[model samples]
Target chain A: MNKLVNQINDLLLQSIPSSPLETNLEESMRYSLEAGGKRIRPVLLIETLKMLSKSDNYEKGIQTALALEMVHTYSLIHDDLPAMDNDDYRRGKLTNHKVYGEWKALLAGDALLTKAFHLISTDGSIDAQTRIKLVELLSDASGHLGMIGGQTLDMESENQNISLETLQHIHKEKTGALLTFAIMAAVTIVQPSDDVSELLEDYSQHLGLIFQIKDDLLDVYGDEDKLGKPVGSDEKNHKNTYVTLLGQDKTEQKLDYHVKQAEKCLEKLREASYDTSQLEYLTQLFYQRDH
Target chain B: MNKLVNQINDLLLQSIPSSPLETNLEESMRYSLEAGGKRIRPVLLIETLKMLSKSDNYEKGIQTALALEMVHTYSLIHDDLPAMDNDDYRRGKLTNHKVYGEWKALLAGDALLTKAFHLISTDGSIDAQTRIKLVELLSDASGHLGMIGGQTLDMESENQNISLETLQHIHKEKTGALLTFAIMAAVTIVQPSDDVSELLEDYSQHLGLIFQIKDDLLDVYGDEDKLGKPVGSDEKNHKNTYVTLLGQDKTEQKLDYHVKQAEKCLEKLREASYDTSQLEYLTQLFYQRDH
Candidate 1:
């Protein structure tokens, strides 16, 4: 699975074109896209398809996966902009807009967002109806009431003390929406059983929340070299986090509980005749990641 | 038809929430969205549906039309940013980023762009299948191969000589793609006869080209009070225009030829029992507009 993940990452890197007018926009998009995070979204998509024995869908799945990753990458680019998070570094490299200038960075993000759908729509591997469904799913995940709305909330909460429920709501939309979309879309395209599909959603939401909590914990405790960013950076910004609200010990406990719930959800699927050990591995991996 | 146009314009303004965000992002978006244009795209779409008597489809068509306008408005917003055309004012008000900061302006453009397909997908009036097609059309029109590509060329041609062939390619993608999508999508949804659809395409393309040329002429000879911006703004920016490339006299002649060709195509459609006199009226309206 990891090997296939690397292969998909390579294909994604090769997908963006370099041209004069591209103006480092490609570099900006590629920098974060190729930044060494786990390609979990696309990998899960492919794995879900493979597990369903619908491997013939892999071609469209790959393109859809790439589109999903592009949307995620574009969000990160804009999120790291000076106006947004003001982060100078991400994944041990200068942030995109910092390196590429704001204008090209903006276009780079915009280009990536649009290209995601364009790739899915134009890619001939998917059936026309399936392609359309993919577009609908993607647009929902990317639009105002999804990730962007969460971003609006995240931005709106800057320098203010937001309640834990508010934080959860924000994260649910911000991170959970895309994470849920990744697994659910793959399942939908792969045509899984209802039981399997329900388990996928359950497992994904659990893992998604665990991922965010662990992300919060890692910001306070992880090594800079291993995390690819400075420790306590979130604290330095005085931003809200699970650690800030729940304390490090409680945050750790909450993350553990979510991971366990995610694993247990997978266990139910294991008995229902799907090969879900890879999902278990993925859930564990998300819980353990630093950056 | 005019009443429907006004209703759409009003509904569009009411549909968009005017609220404070991290900055004036919402305001910047609303500024361009609410700016009084002719609602030409929406009018064309509604009229197209009216001709087809697909009033049952009007609900989706109206939303799609609004989405189209949003895409169009976002283009204008980004085009007016400092890194693009650098215009301080548009439609007699500060450009998006001018009233809001650059960051908000960029995000507002993004929000509007992403919301377009969101509107289409979530609208219950349209089947998910048709929503998908609309997404494909809008995404292709907005992507790097379309409007963005044209924008790159336009920026590249600043203060440089551009051939008529190159100009056509740029305008076709930049301006004509959305216009073509407008008519094509309606016909596709209405399931019109192939001959009628093809005629509409020809009519739209020719009229779109004429519209571009008239815009060039207007920039050089329009009234500021009427045009909502200073005349000769294009020349002042050292931007290439049809008038500059073909000379004013020839450009005017070209515009007349295309407008007549557009009308002629519409005449064929009428003879085919399409009763598309509204489209003919739209073509003449664009050709005759001073601004």
Candidate 2:
């Protein structure tokens, strides 16, 4: 897992353009890309590829994985803008907007999002059809219908009494969509059957739930030093999180329920004759992540 | 020209999503996209396709064309943000941030940018390679070292004593790159030869300069009632435009020079056996546009 994470990191570094523009948009892009997060999305993508036994072109998979990270990193950069989350720190360092001013930060985020499409489309090693498929899934997950929509809801839902259903919807779209895409990305590349996709969706949805619930838990109880940022941000922003909705004990129970559900989905996939160990292991990491 | 512009307008309206997220992100996207302009970018793209005789895939070409407009609109939305240009009026209407507030405005721009990739990729009628090529060129133009890079320079060069060459470099990149891509986009779909591409670059670069110079001229001497926005904005922003750098008479001379130069390149393409009538027509419109 560590080796796979390192490879994803290396691919991300290599993917940053070394163009001769006097502007530091590239630098701003690299600043966020190299901020040293868990690399969980790419790791999950590569691991899913391995579990499905479609690991023939590891380099190509890594590029798509890098694009996924680019999307994620760009989201973080834009979310940190003063117009949005106004975050000053992320992953223990100054946010992109903090390191660079708002203008460059905004452009950097735009560049990264643009680069994701550029990378996915130009990855010649991936079959053209699958490239199209990947682009479709990634953009759907990242654009108005998925992450961006969820983010909008997240903002609007702030300081207002919201339903558990609304919170779940936000969770699913805002963060779940991309994490789910991290899995679907591999499935598209592998060209798996529709049956595999159904099961993977089940697994991916459960994984997304667990990830979001655990995030709420960490915000309430986890150590900031380990998390690399303050833990009370949801409350600071008056967000309607799981902890706020269900209380700490109920939220923890919800987290456990989703973990068991995710494991059951993996079990079903294993019964379908695919190795599920790597995915299973990653689920454990998500379940236990402090940050 | 009117028909093409109407089609571009229709495509822009149809492309905006009516999803159920309950935030004005989509509203903001539509607000800016629906904001009336010359539809210059898409007109350039479609006209270039017409000139190159690749009008068979007109629907597919228009989707790419819509993506171009989305890119342009998204840039305008971001460029108007408080962190950037901070303007309250665009195309004679309240800017997006002013209408939807800053956060939704930012997300709307992000969504529009992401949707460009979505539209371009999901246009199944276009072959995979051409789609990939479009994605690459669009990203290169829209990302750093292209539009965003040019924008960065435009921002940085503000209130600074800069040279004509530096100003031109910024204009070429800021607005010119995507205009160049609009032409290259058609050429790629048509599968034109290397020599044609070289001549297209010559044509594209000059067209970009002419467009920027005319924009600067409008900012200085055009009527607000006709132009749909206030004039003297370049001075208000302290932007060192072509008019600022060359005085009114000299900027007019430069615009004339580029128009002639652009015509020469079109003549070269005509000699190379491609009809340059539609592209020639668009440039005349650029030359004569008061708004």
Candidate 3:
């Protein structure tokens, strides 16, 4: 897992070259991309591909993984803007808008988002049909119908009493969609059997829920030094989360349910003669991570 | 041209449906897109495809054309944000941020940009290879190395002296790249001969310059009613433009030069037995329009 994380970090660092033009747009883009998250999405993508293919020639998935990371990074940058969440720090470092002014950070985010498509489109390892599918899936996942829609709903729900269903819907689209994309993109690349695909999809859905529920849990219960920001920000911002809707104990129970379901899916995969160790480990990490 | 503009407008209107989710993000996106401009970019694309193919079956190019316009529209929305131009109006209507607040406007722009790629990827009329090529070209034209880079240079040059070369370079990327994509996308659709492609490239380059130079001229000498905004905002903003760098007469001369060069490219196309009348008329309109 550490090896895959290091590989993703290296590729991301090498992704956006310094522009010869007289603008720091590239610098601003690089700054956010280099700010260093856990690389969870890309790692999931690569690991899924590896587990399904049973081969180390996961090179074909690298560009797509990078593209997913880029999309995630762009969302973070925009979410940190003053017009959005307005955070000054992320991951123990100054946010993109803090390092590069608001406008530069905004454009940098746009550029990164645009470059993600460029990367997928130009990946020579993939066939044109697969590339098109990737683009379609990615746009649908990240566009208004998915992540952005969730963001809007989340924003509007602020300071208002929201139902449990509404909170789940928001988290499903806002965070689950991209994580599902990571797994599904790998599935798309590997072209598993229909039954296997269904199993993987089920696993991915459970994993997505586990990831977000844990995020809500960590925000209220995790260490600030480890999380790189203060806890209870969701409450401070009057934002609803799983913990808010279900209470800490109930949220923990919900998280356990999803983790068990995700593990069951992995067991099914293993029964079908696929190596599920990497993915099983990922499920545990999402279930137990501090950040 | 009017027919093409109307078609493009209708398509833009139908492109983004209202979200079933409890969010107005879709409305904000639709608002800016429906805030009518001339739809010059899409018209250029369809018209270019029409001229190149010598056939009226330009249906295959419509989605790509819409994609180009979305890219242009997204840039405008981002440009009008408070951190950028902070404009109150566009096309005689309230700018998106003014109408929808700042954060929603930002997300709308991001969504629109993502949808552009979605449009091209899902364009069934074109082959997968063609779709990939369109994605590659569109991203290159709009990403950090192109329009966004130009915008950064433009923003950084505010209140600073810049050379004619730098100013031209900035416009070439900032405004000209997407226009070039308008023409080049048509060429990509038609798969024209190399020589014809080269000629169209030259014409598009000149057209891009004509568009920007005329824009600079219009800022200084055109009527506010025609432009739907104040004329001297460029000067007020301390932004460097062709008019500021070269004065009105020389900027007019520059526009004229590009117009002639664009006409020459069209004449070459005509000699090669392609209908160039539409492009010739567009050149004249760009040269003579007040807005």
Candidate 4:
């Protein structure tokens, strides 16, 4: 995981522009990118690649992983904007808008998003068709149908009492869709068997739920110092969450349920003779995160 | 031009999302897209495709042309935001934030940008390699090294009283790069000869200057009714434009010079056996437009 995080960090730093005209744009992007959060998306993609293939072609998917991280980072930057969550800090650092002002931070997020597509579009290592497929899936996950759509819904649901189903739908797109794309992009690159691919898809859905639920739990109970940002933001914003809908007790049960389901899918992959060790470890880490 | 404008208007209407979750996003995008301005970028792309190819593949590139429009529209939406331009009107209609508020306007811009890439990535009429190249060029024109870079420069140059060299550098990327890409993307799709390609590159560079100079002229002397929004925004923002650097009379001269140069390149393309009538007419119309 550390190796993958380092690789992702390096590629991210390198992929952003170093132009004199847009140094502030690059600086704004690098500010959030290097703020030392857990590189969960790329780590999941790399681990998924390891589980699915024997050849060290995992190295080839490194660019795609980096692209995933860029999308994640850009989304975070945009999400923390004064227009959205109004977040002042993220991961113990001043939020992008805090450091760069609103407009520059917004452009930084735009650059990061455009640069993510730019990276994949220019990647010579990936064949043209594969790259297009990656773009298709990634765009679907990031755009109106996925992350942005989910975000819109998330904002709309704020201060409004919403159904549990709607909450799940929001998370699936806002959080789960990209996570699914990360794992599925690995599947697309490696061309795994239909059964393996199906299993992985199911695995990622539950993993997404677990991740979101963990996030909700962390907001409620995690250490403020280690978590790097204030908690109770959802409450303050009147935003819906797993904890809000299911209650803390039921949200805990829900988190446990999804984690176990994710583990079961991993066990099934193991039964199919796939190497599931790294994925299993990551799954445990998701359940075990304290900060 | 009317035909292309109507076609673009329809496609823009269709391309944006209609999801109940993001109807506001779609509405915000549609507001700018359907604001009834001249569809210059898409017209440039479609006309260039007409100039280059015979197989009606330009029909396929229509989606790409719409994507370019979306990028232009998205930029306009963001640029008109309270955080950016703080405009109350565009093209005789309310600015997006005036209608949908800041957050939705931002997300709508984001969705439009993402959807632009989505259109290119998922375009089946073009081959994957060509699509990849288009993405490469378009993203380059839109990302940090291009429009966004130009935007950042534009923002920074405000209140700085920068030089003509810096101002031109900013517009070349912010305004000129995408205009070039609209023409250059058609070149990529048609697989034009290197000579024609290089000529169009030069042509679009001149065309870009003409467009920006014309815009500066419009902002100074254009009708509020015909120009949609009020004029003098450049002055209001304290932006450094061609008129600012050269004075109105000299900027008029500059516009004429570029228009002549662009027409010369168009004639060269005509001599090279590529019919350039549409491009020629468009150039003349640009020179004559009062709005």
Considering only chain B, report the TM-score of each candidate against the true chain B: 0.93, 0.95, 0.98, 0.94
Q: After aligning candidate 2 to the native by TM-score, how far in Å is the CA of B69 from where it should be?
A: 0.3
Each prediction's TM-score versus the true structure: 0.91, 0.95, 0.99, 0.97
User: What is the TM-score ranking, best to worst?
Assistant: 3, 4, 2, 1
**Candidate 1, A115-225: lDDT as tens digits:** 887778777776766776677777777766667767777777768998998888778878988888888778767777788878888888887799889888888888878
RMSD values for the candidates in order, in angstroms, are 3.1, 2.0, 1.0, 1.6
Candidate 4 stretches greater than 4 Å from native? B20-23, B55-57
lDDT of each: 0.78, 0.87, 0.91, 0.87
| Model 2, residue pairs in steric clash | none
Query: What would the per-residue lDDT of candidate 2 be over residues A1-291, giving only the tens digit for each residue?
Result: 777777777778778866665767788889999996888888888888877764544665777888899999999999999898888888778999898899889998998898898898888788877787788889899999999999999999989999999999999999999999999888887767898888888889989998999888898899988987778978988989999999998998888998898888888888888888888888999999887
What is candidate 1's DockQ? 0.41
Cα lDDT tens digits for candidate 1, B88-207: 887777788777776667677887887786677666776666777777778877776677767766776778877888888889978988888888778866877888878888988997
For residue A105, give model 1's deviation from the true position in Å. 2.5
What is the Cα-based lDDT of residue A229 in candidate 2? 74
DockQ of candidate 4, scored on C-alphas against the true complex (2 decimals)? 0.77
Better of 1 and 2 by TM-score: 2
Cα lDDT tens digits, model 4, A210-261, are 8899999998888887787778877887889888888899999888899889
Assign candidate 1 its CAPRI class.
acceptable
Q: Pick by lDDT: which candidate is best?
A: 3
Per-prediction DockQ, in order? 0.41, 0.77, 0.89, 0.77
Displacement of the residue A125 alpha carbon in candidate 1, Å: 4.7
